[model samples]
Target: MLIRFKSPVAADVLMLGDNAQQLLRLVGREGQLKGIFEVDDQPHIIELLDAAVAAEAQAAEAAADAGGKAPARPLVSLRQRVWPLREMLHQAHRERVAVVWGV
Candidate 1:
């Protein structure tokens, strides 16, 4: 299933089910078929996601620094995958709009 996130202030953002669920998990909204990110909550959600991405990057770097077999790189990094949704959240926050998914 693909999740389509829509907001009045930005273009719709789309993600695969598992990927979308993982992103939602960062903000404590996982396992729902449908949900909303209210304007009031967007900033916190963004911060959580940014921190999670940064942590993932740091962990990957640490693994590489350990000098075993270099960790296999993901075709798409978490940061790249989350960019669109992050932009949507930022736009919604700035414009005081809510983002809704699975609508």
Candidate 2:
């Protein structure tokens, strides 16, 4: 299924099942499908997403650093995938708007 995150301050962002779940988890919204972010949760969600992205990048870098005969499995890094959600969340917070996924 595709999830659409809508906010008044930015363009709508659509994500597929896996990608949507990834964003939900990164922003600590795994259980959320549609809802408004609490004022206090906006910054916190952004922080969590940032940390998750950084951690994934670090892990990918570590795997790359382990240069040897064993080829490292290619992983889909979050940088590109999460950009829209991150931006949406930032805009949501800035505009004091709500973001909803689905319908």
Candidate 3:
């Protein structure tokens, strides 16, 4: 399943179901099929997502610093995966609009 996140200020963002659910959980909205991120809530949601990404990066860096073996090739980080939705939230906040999905 795929989730389509829509906002008046930006193009819709499509994400894999599990990935989208994880992101929703980050923003304190888990197991929700239909929901909205109000304009006032965008900043806090964005902050939560950003902090999760930052934490992931920090953990990876710490492991490397501890002499852990690196993967043979680079993998797509959560930062990369969540960038579009993050930007969408930013646009929504800037436009003072809400983002909704499964509505």
Q: Which 10 successive residues of model 3 have the least lDDT summed?
A: 69-78
- Per-candidate TM-scores read 0.95, 0.80, 0.92
- Using lDDT as the measure, what is the rank order of every candidate, best first? 1, 3, 2
Task: Report the number of the highest-lDDT candidate.
Answer: 1
Candidate 1 CA-lDDT value: 0.91
lDDT of 3 by residue, 2-103 (tens): 899999889999988888998999889999988999999999999999999998888878878989975443466789888999999999998899999987
RMSD to the true structure for each prediction, in A, is 0.9, 2.5, 1.7
**Candidate 1 lDDT score at position 72:** 84
Task: Using TM-score, rank the candidates from best to worst.
Answer: 1, 3, 2
lDDT of each: 0.91, 0.76, 0.89
Per-candidate count of clashing residue pairs (backbone under 3 Å): 0, 0, 0
lDDT of 3: 0.89
Q: Model 1, 1-103: lDDT tens per residue?
A: 9999999889899899999999988889989989999888899999999999999998888888998676788898899988999999998898899999999
